[model samples]
Target: MAVITKYVVERSGVEKMTFTSKAEADAYDKMLDTADALQVLLSASNQLTDEAQAEALALYLAQQKEPLLVALGVKKAAKAGKQDSEEQTTAKQDDTSSKGLKAVAAGHAA
Candidate 1:
């Protein structure tokens, strides 16, 4: 028998998302919180009259906060670009390394 544990992020007593990792669940909750805060701030401006549009904008802004900060001069674009390249290199390395390991395991199993 096997048991699996799931992390759920709830908003207003409703399950909004479920994740197999706690880190992802927590990050999602933080994003949701940021969106809620941004929505309130945008509502105060009164520029976006439609509530749905305001909410949508808030979520978008929250999700793209890194790029938003860079565009607003609050973050360095160079740093973001470096991080992206590093992540891509790491992903490529993992894919290549796992391929050889999988082949070795398969040969031993056969």
Candidate 2:
């Protein structure tokens, strides 16, 4: 009998790619994870179109700044036909408010 190890990759909880080597899979996964983090900020901004946000995020990564640290909640996949754009927009605002509060608290402590 032979045993095989496969490197499965995912982004935003959806499988994206697969690799034969752990190093390759991990590298790609890390990049995707970073992009996901950036997307949260981009999504909340509502200023840039999706395309522009992606480009801006890539530029930021190219500069090699320390990655933004955000504590994310485990969100269930929205039920079909239950969530619409309006709800999504409101949720984004709520998320931004929480993040802002965290920043203010940190500032007060410092």
Candidate 3:
């Protein structure tokens, strides 16, 4: 039998995802953590209709964090040394542009 290796991301003892590459698994896990933190922040807002809406908004914020950061003045431009080169920035935006909130939360590139 051949050997197979996989990186699994688990939450609360339950496997949430499996990836062929460790990087992919790690990234997905990080995204989840971000969403959870955002959820807590949203909770303090007291404006969310319910937990479901809070969770959705949190995930969307996590998935679109890069642009959101820039728009919020939290991330500086490449010329200011906070980002990569212009071409790399363009490519990253292009890759994420097609993905919806769910696709990005799943660590997928559309």
Candidate 4:
């Protein structure tokens, strides 16, 4: 008799499917890891119930049509852009304030 090794996938506490190959199983497991990471990131907490974490993971997996890794790159770019914009705004405000201070000092000197 030939022994077969299979991987089981469970969803919501129920058995969902099985994979015949280790690579396939590893891929699914990695997806779950990504979901868990995302949940922690979005909630800023690691104390979520199993159901809540699973829900978040499922939602993330479903929302992405492409690979999840690609979305992370896009998110990083967007965050960097936002930071740059905020820095520009703060610099402008500082410049305006310094100019106002200079004008006040000149008036007092007159």
Candidate 5:
């Protein structure tokens, strides 16, 4: 009964796909900005230096941001599922109370 939402990221002529909770989406965007900075540093260097390797590692982490967001979505879904069950229980209790009140008004219950 729960609906999943999809988000898309377009960068460097490639379209990236992701699904995430709102918080995760925001975090991923911030991480992506950091990744972009690393990319710029990597491009400016002509040699495969230590700095370039470090930048590459940062870029890899950035690419993983989307997967991390998806993991967040899984956790969110579990929490949301529990919340939905609680809401349903409350609704059923309300219905039962209403039915009892109607029966009492009609002299069907003491």
Candidate 6:
């Protein structure tokens, strides 16, 4: 059997994690240390209120913003384009049927 180790991120005395290897444990420890440092900096900076800490923590977890925004923008544009195409197709069908009815009416009048 292999020994499984754990790494924890402690904030306000709460710790949580699991690591399969020493390297993974070390990496997690480093991440936790960095997070602690960032929290200290944030507190010192006076940039976040108590209510804003969660958002700050989330930003730390993700590490960067540009890539996230790009991904979200791509998904939003794709969704909008699909909706536009569906609406256009429905409008075209409606117009075709309306024109066909007009043609049939004209033939009957003649």
Per-candidate clash tally: 0, 0, 0, 0, 0, 0
Clashing pairs in 5: none
What is the alpha-carbon RMSD of candidate 4 to the true structure?
15.1
Q: Kindly indicate the candidate among 3 and 6 with the higher lDDT.
A: 3
Q: Model 5: runs farther than 4 Å from truth?
A: 49-56, 61-110
Backbone collision tally, model 2 = 0
Mind giving the per-residue lDDT tens digits that candidate 5 earns over 1-110?
99878666656767654646666766666777888776776667655557757677677867776565557673345467789999999999999999999988889545
Question: Could you estimate the TM-score for every candidate?
Answer: 0.70, 0.39, 0.65, 0.40, 0.37, 0.40
RMSD values for the candidates in order, in angstroms, are 10.2, 19.1, 17.5, 15.1, 10.5, 12.1
Give the runs in model 6 whose Cα sits over 4 Å from its true position.
1-14, 51-110
lDDT of 6 by residue, 1-110 (tens): 98655555455777656655778767666766665666676677666768378446744754533344457673445567789999999999999999999999999999
User: Residue 61 deviation, candidate 4, in Å?
Assistant: 3.7
The whole-model C-alpha lDDT of candidate 6 against the native structure comes to 0.67
Q: What is the lDDT of residue 59 in candidate 6?
A: 44
lDDT of 4 by residue, 4-109 (tens): 9989977679875689988987777677666666665656554555767656665676446254545656444556778999999999999999999999999999
Where is the poorest 10-residue window by lDDT in model 1?
A: 73-82
| Predicted model with the maximum lDDT | 1
Candidate 3 lDDT, tens digit per residue, 1-110? 98889999998999989999999999999998999999999999999969999999999999888878878998875465634576688887877775656577787553
Residue pairs in candidate 1 whose N, alpha carbon or C atoms collide under 3 angstroms = none
TM-score of 2: 0.39
The alpha-carbon lDDT assigned to residue 4 of candidate 1 equals 94
**Candidate 1 Cα deviation (angstroms), residue 91:** 24
Ranking by TM-score: 1, 3, 6, 4, 2, 5
